[model samples]
Structure formats: C-alpha cells, structure tokens
Target: MVGLLPRFRRYRLVLLGLFLLLPLALLLGAGLGAYPIPPLTIPEILLRGEGVEYQVLTALRFPRVLGAALVGALLALAGAVLQGLFRNPLVDPGLIGVSSGAALGAALFIVLIPGAGALETYALPLSAFLGGLAATLFLWQIARTPWGVQVSVLLLAGIALNALVGAGIGLLTFLATEQELRSLTFWTLGGFSALTWPLLLVGLPLALLALALLLPLARPLNALALGEREAFHLGVHLEDLKRRSVVGSALGVGVAVALAGGVGFLGLVAPHLFRLLAGPDHRYLLPGSALLGAILAVSADLLARTLAAPAEVPVGVVTALLGGPFFLYLVLRYKREVYRA
Candidate 1:
C-alpha cells in the first residue's frame, strides 16, 4: 500500500504538470499572430495597466487564444470519453451529429436572421448548445429501450444523425445569400477570433468541472471496455455509467461545438494517439489524451493563424485536412487487424 501510494502521487503530479502547462500554451498562443507580440511582453501587457498594446493583448489575443485552448481541450476530452464509451477508436463527438446540429442552428441565426445584430452573439451560442443537447438526448433515448441498452444501436443512431445533419447543412448552404453563405461556410470551418473573455469565463470553468466529474469514471469505463456482462459481474452498474458518460460527454461536446463550430476527428484521433504513447489504462489514457489533444489543437490554431498571414484560415480546416487522412489510416489498420484475428 505504501509503494502504491507513491506511484499514485507521481501520476497525480503529472496531471498537475499538464494543468499548469495549459496556461503557458495559451500565453504563447496569444503572442503568435499577425502583429506578433513578443512573448515576454505578453505577460507584461496582461499584467500592466491599460495601453494600446495592453488593449490589443487583452481584447484581441487573450480572448481568442484562451478560447482556442479551452475549446480544444473540451473537444479532445469529449473525444476521449466518446471513444472510451463506444469502445471504438473512430468514435468522435462530431460523429453523433452534435456539432453539425449546432452548426445548423448557428447558420439559421446568422443567415436566416441577419437582422438580429446585437443579439447575434448570445443567440448563436445558445441555439448551437440547444441543438447539440437535443441531438444527444434524442440519440440517447433511441439507444435506450425498456429491455436494456445496446451500444450498437447508439452507434447506428449517431451515424444516421451525422448523415442527416450533414445533408441539412448542405441544403442551408445552397439557399444562403452570397455574404451569408461566406459567413456560414467560415463558421462551419471554424475560427477562434470571435472569442471573448466572457465566453471563456463561462466555458473554461464548465470544462474544468466536466473533466473533474468524468476523470473519476475512468475506472468504470475501463472495466466496461472488457465487456458489460463481465463488468456487471464485477459490480459495475451499466445504467449509471451510461447515463453519466452520455451527460458528461454531451456537456463537453455542446460547449465545444457552441464555441468552435464542427471541428471533427479530434475525439477519435487523440485517444488512439495517447493509447499508443501511454497504453490503454483509462486513468492514464484520459489525461494523456487531454495533453495530446491540447497540443494538436493549439498547434493547428497556430498554423491557421500564420499559414495565410494577415488573413487567417479557419482552424477547423487545419484539423480536418490532417485528421481526415489520419482517421482513414486508423480505419484501414483496424480492418487489417480484424482480418488477421
């Protein structure tokens, strides 16, 4: 017991290191941009009183960078949870149509109701959150029957929802006006420049809370991964775990989709990558996935900002172009392993 306690403390220290590093990444992310503030000046500007540079740091870079980090963390965490729950490396929060539904809601607000000027900000995030929440609940209900629950049913429902939402987004795109279409297209692709401190304040704590809640469930999830019947024999409550996973993942996905458009594949990709580095223990897997996810997201955001110089490419485009090929590779690899077995 004494020896085990030391190892546990070491692991806890590693989690602490990750938590500390996140803020540093945000600081660096804020400093890298068109104007390209000096890294040293970043803290100075932030800590010092009001000035032009301070204004730029506080108003422009701080909010956007914080948003990038926060949203990236949320998406990656959601990906970790979803993949663990489904026991499918390909499962992402986006696969369940949550992000696309949010996109549709945001599009409706921006395009169909362009006249809503002042209220647009709150409306878009709220509508997006509602859309995602609705989709998650709908999928959950479909997967849960009176007899019991079936993961395959949930997987099928999510795939169907994704297809339907993608089609709806296309239709909305076709009907949109030229300017509205451009904005809608950009939103779908994802951007971080619209981030404000208020939004970050709202989202960051919820993300933290969600992580705090979900991290403890890692043991049950790891157990269920073996097989639910086996897990049941070992004293795991199937219903309780499922409900907690669905609710926790939904909250993370809803907040992330609301903030960052429909960024896909992070959830699917991050966990597998972490498993490769850190192995399949959910306790280690979850936090490792968080670290890798944040790295991927922040790195992608850096590319998005600099790749086009003054005009930024959407961060989603960067993630998608990279994640798409990676996902295909994983899928093909999984097929080969199945055939081999």
Candidate 2:
C-alpha cells in the first residue's frame, strides 16, 4: 500500500491534465465553425452577453459545444466501465449492438409516424434512446448465465442483435419516403450539430444522473478486474456490480445515442488511450476516459464541421474510419490468443 501511493499520485497528475484538456478542446471546437469564430473571443462573448456575436456564441455554438462535450464524456465513461466489466480491452459501448438497436428504433419510428413532420427533427434521438435501452435489456436477459455472466456469450449476443437491428434499419431505409430516407440516413451516420438548447436540457440531466450513479461503482469495478472469484474474496458483490455496470452503461449510452446518433469508437478508444497513459485503476481510468473521449469527440466534430465545409461529413463516418483500422489491428494482434482461449 505504501509503495503504491507514489504511483497513484503520478496517475492523479495525469488525470488532472485530462480534466483540463476536456474543456479546452470543447472551447476550441466551439470556436472553429463555418463562421471561423476565434477561440479567445468565445468566453468574452458568452460572459458579457453582447449583441449578435453573443447570440451566435450562446444560442448556437455554446449549446453544441456543451452537447458534444457531454456526449463524448458519457460515451468514454461508459466505455471504461464496459471494458472493465468484461475485462476486454477491445470492448466499446456499442460493442453489443446498442447503437444498432438504437438506430433501428429511430428508423422504425420515422417509418411509422404520420403527419408528425415537425417532430421528426427530434424523434430520431428519442427513438434511439428507447431502442438502445430495450436492446440492452433484451441482450442482458439472453446472456444471463447460471454460473455468472460470460463475456463470450455477451459479445456473441451483441453481434447477433447488431445484425438483426442493422437489417431492420436497412428495411426501414428501403421503405422510407425520399425525404424521410435522407434524414434517417444522415442521422444513422451520426453528427452532433443537431443539438439545440431544449434537447441539451433533456439530455444533460439524464447524462449527469447516469455518470453520478456510475462514479461510485469505480472501486467495485476495479475489484472485479481482479476476476470474479478474487473480487468476491475482497468483499465485492458480483451480481450487484454487474447490475450497476450494465444498467449504468445502458443509461449513459442511451442518452449519448439520443444526442449524437450512434457515434462510434469514442468509447473503445478513449478508455484504452487513457489507461495506457494513466494506468488501469478505475479511479483514474474512468475520469481519464471521459477527458480523452471529450478530446476525441470534440476534435472529430471539428473535423466533421470543417472537412467538407458547407457539406459536413458525418461524425460517425470519421469515427468508423479511424476506429475500423484500429479494431482490425486489435483483432489481428489478439487472434492467436483468442483462438487458443
């Protein structure tokens, strides 16, 4: 214990850096948009409540920035929890088809709703949240084992659910009116600029509640990383921890999907990146993941807004493009170990 304190202190310093970086990147993202607002001027306009610039900064850019930051942090926090839960370095929030399920739900609503054109703007996010939660519950029921949860079973269920949800989304797309189809397709691809103050008001509370709930579980999560039997020996309740983790992850991811439409890989990458930088104790890992996730997401949003200029590239596409290659590498590197297991 004595020897570990120094190492822990060092890790804390690194996490402090991540916390500071989260807001810095958010401000940077907010400042750089189609209008090319300056970063330094953002705070002044926001604080002083001046004229037109203030409105742009407050009404539009500020909300978007906050939304992105919250989504990023939530996804990353979920990722850290999930990776620890399964003891798998490759796991992400969307690993188990939660994102697909959410997409399917949103698509189905768009297909079925009538004369609800104006509501269509916000319908997808709501649908996605419901879909993600339902799918997680369904997966949980199917994957529950008498001997305790099996990571293999959980992952397989996610893959199967993803396929089913993907197919449903596809069918919805095929049947959609051209206008609805365009909207649905863009949303499924994931982007963050759709944020509005009202939407943020709804999402922020849910996100905060989820994060607050999960934060206390960090110590238990770290214990579980030592293996279930070992954790039990250390007085951790296996079932309770699993319940909290699954529910918390679902809640966080659901809200994030509601806001950001199936943004990918931020969860998987952020936690791991921070773990590499700050070490694996959940006390550090969770917060570190949030910061890194924010950095990755806000940076990605910046790229999405700027890369195509007037026509934005979907945020999901950028994450997939970056995350896909890295995922492939992880698979290849772990192939032998996976096969042996």
Candidate 3:
C-alpha cells in the first residue's frame, strides 16, 4: 500500500504533464506552417473566419492537427492494451497485419478505381476499413484454440498475414500506372494531407469507439499481466479481454490507415515511454500513452511540414526516422534486463 501510493502520485503527475503537453503540441502544429499564424492571433483568426489566415487555421491546420492527435491516440491506446494483453513489449498494432491490410486496401482502390472524384473521399476509407476488419477476423480465428487465443500462434500468424498482404500490395504496385504509382507510394508513406473536416467525421467516431473499447480494459489487462491463470483466478475474463484488445486495436489502426495512410510506431513508442516513467500500471499507462502519442504525432507532423519548407515529408517517414532508434533502445533495455535476471 505504501509503495502503491507513491506510484499513484507519480501517475497523476505524469498524466497531468501529458494533458498540458497536448495543447502545446496542437498550438505549435496549428501555428507553424507555410503561412505561419502567430499563436496570439489564432483566436482572432478563428473567430473572424474570413481571411486567408482564418481559412488556413480553421479549414486546414485545425482538422489536420486534430486528426493527427486522434489517430495517434488511437494507435497508442490500442498499443498499450495489446502490449498488456499479449504480454509483449515489442508488439504494435501493425504487428497484427492491420496496417499492411489497410495499405493493400488503399493500393487496390488507387490502382483499380482509375477515376479521382467524390467517390474516392468515401471509397478509400471504406475499403481500408473492410480490409483491416478482414485481417483482424482472420487473425482472431487462427489464433483461437480450444483453450483460448494463443499469443505465440497469433504472433506467427500475424507475420504470415503481413507477408501475404505485402504481396498483394506489390502486385497492385506492379499494375499501377505512373501517376497511380506516385499516389500509391505517397499514401503508403503517410501524411495528414487528406484529413480535412469531412474525413474527420468518419474517423472521430471510430476513434471514440476504440477508446471506449480499449481504455476500460486497463484493470483487466493489469491483472492479465500477472499471467492468464492468475488473471482468470482474479475474475478477469481472459478470452474477452483478448478479443476486445485485438478488435479495438484493429479498429483504431484501420481508422488511422484509412485517414492518414500508414502512420507507424506511435503505438510502440508511446506505451514504452510511459512504462519507463511510471512503471507498467495500465490505469495510467493506457491514457498516458495516448496523450503522449498525440503530442509526438503532432510534433512529428509539424516537423514534417516545416523541415522541408514549401515541400512536405510524409509523417510516417518522420515517425519511422524517430522511432527506429527508440525501438533499438527498447531492445537493448530488454536485453540488459534479461541478462540481469
């Protein structure tokens, strides 16, 4: 109880920091762009909603930043739950083939549709969601045994699924026209370029749903971390937890891929960061990771937009550049701990 109190207090502080940090990131993302809007003038710009500044702030930056935060939160929220559910530090939503499936789906639409019009606005996201849902269901089926979902088998199956999805994407790429190939490449690489308010409508509700599904499972996930038998003994329905975690994760990743294209590693980076700060208590870890993920994503998008000035880099490329080293660090940290044990 004594040890618990200090950890609890630390959790509160970490959570508070994240909440405060998020608005700052949003402000920066909104303010720093080609036509920079001073933070102080942003309110005036938004309220007036008449000038170029107003249009840029209200119509462009607001939705893009907000969408980035939403998708980042979903990715991290799902990552924290999946990590705890599967009891693996390295597990990401992408590990289960959701991103690949979503990418392949987008590729198919880009290559096959052949016409760019209003239909694309709805069609691309729908196709991505269906593809992701299909992968999730297939993964769940193969991983389910008479006993329960087997973590090892799930991981193996996910790898195989990703490979197959990759092949499909490759085939689509081969068939794509020159212009289609550029669009497809950029889409797979990822950006918030397409995330206007209309698109956010499709994503926001789904992100909220993912949050509702995954965040509440924190306590159960914490118990499951003790071991499946221990968790069951403590009244955590191991099967249900596994099901929700996987489904919720796939849903969030699907929305992310649908809206932003293949934004990666916010999932893997955010949860591990929270663990480093406050230990692995999911009550804080899940939401904390989501908050931090939002901050990182907003910041990454900011850098993506500004670093190249008039030209923009893919947010996914930025995240991967940042996350790659951090991933290596996690592996090294894990190695040291294992050697010590």
Candidate models: Cα lDDT each: 0.78, 0.84, 0.89
Clashing pairs in 1: 79-267
| Better model by lDDT: candidate 2 vs candidate 3 | 3
Best by lDDT: 3
For candidate 1, what is the TM-score? 0.91
Per-residue lDDT tens digits for candidate 2, residues 258-319, read: 89887888898888777667688898888788878888988888898899897889999999
Q: What is the C-alpha RMSD of each candidate to the true structure, in Å?
A: 2.8, 2.2, 1.1
Stretch of 10 with least lDDT, candidate 2: 114-123
> Please, what are the lDDT tens digits per residue for candidate 1 over residues 79-161?
88778878887788776657866877887777778667768676788888888888888888898889666778987998898
Candidate 1 minimal-lDDT segment of 10 residues: 6-15
117-202 in candidate 3: lDDT tens per residue? 88988899888888888888888899988898997888889999999998888889899999999989998888997888989997
What TM-score would each prediction reach against the true structure? 0.91, 0.93, 0.97
Instruction: Name the best candidate (by TM-score).
Output: 3
